[model samples]
Target: MSTKLELPIQEFTTPYPVTAREDSSIEELLDIVKNLKVRHIPIMSNGKITGIVSDRDLRIVSALSAREKFLVRADDLMTSDPVTFQGNTSIEDVILEMSEKKIGSVLVADEKGDLQGIFTVTDALDVLIEILRGRK
Candidate 1:
């Protein structure tokens, strides 16, 4: 029973994820998270990915005063230059990299460096659950 995880990540990636602009307000970010029920929002500048903000990141600043939150923007609190991988990248490699970096998600881009999608730890878990079920 070979359990090799060598498949391309595109099959499991969440394609065309919702994104935010660098200058988007913290409130806008929060709205996106709440309304869309998504955990991560890639920050874009000039149509290119610049950073990422996760639900955890937002929660960290949730304690800030209302005025302070209003003054904040996506770029102000996002993780800059988040780890990225091509959609064709192997699942094992992507998972290993995410584990090494201790990150919840990684952006997937095309060869032209355009944002393609996002693969999160939750996605990985889903993949694992599928594999385990197949083994049963």
Candidate 2:
């Protein structure tokens, strides 16, 4: 019997993920983050991705600019030029990349840079759990 390990990220990624505009207010992104229970949100502008916002970004902004909450926007705190990968990339590479970069998630885009989905640490954990179960 053989066990497969080199699975493509598309097999487990969260496709068509929720996104937000770079101009969105911190309060709005916070609401979305809480309601969706998702940490990373791809930030877009003019139908083009500009950055990614995360819970950490929001927390930093909120804590640093407590008096200027109204002045903070996604663009002000987003991680510009976030790491991205194609769906065909292997799961091992995904985890390796994230581990090397110390990031929790990466955007999934096609050759044309079209937004497809997101692959996060949670997804990686799920894959790990599946592998462990299969080994049992």
Per lDDT, the best of the predicted structures is: 1
Which candidate should be chosen as best, given TM-score against the real structure?
1
Score candidate 1 by lDDT. 0.93
Clashing pairs in 1: none
Q: Write the per-residue lDDT of candidate 1 for residues 1-136, one digit (tens) a residue.
A: 9575888888899999999999999899999999999999999999999999999999999999999999899999999999999999999899989999899999999999999999999999988888789841
CA RMSD, predictions in order: 1.9, 2.6
* Lowest-sum lDDT 10-residue window in model 2: 58-67
Candidate 2 regions off by >4 Å?
1-4, 64-67
lDDT of each: 0.93, 0.88
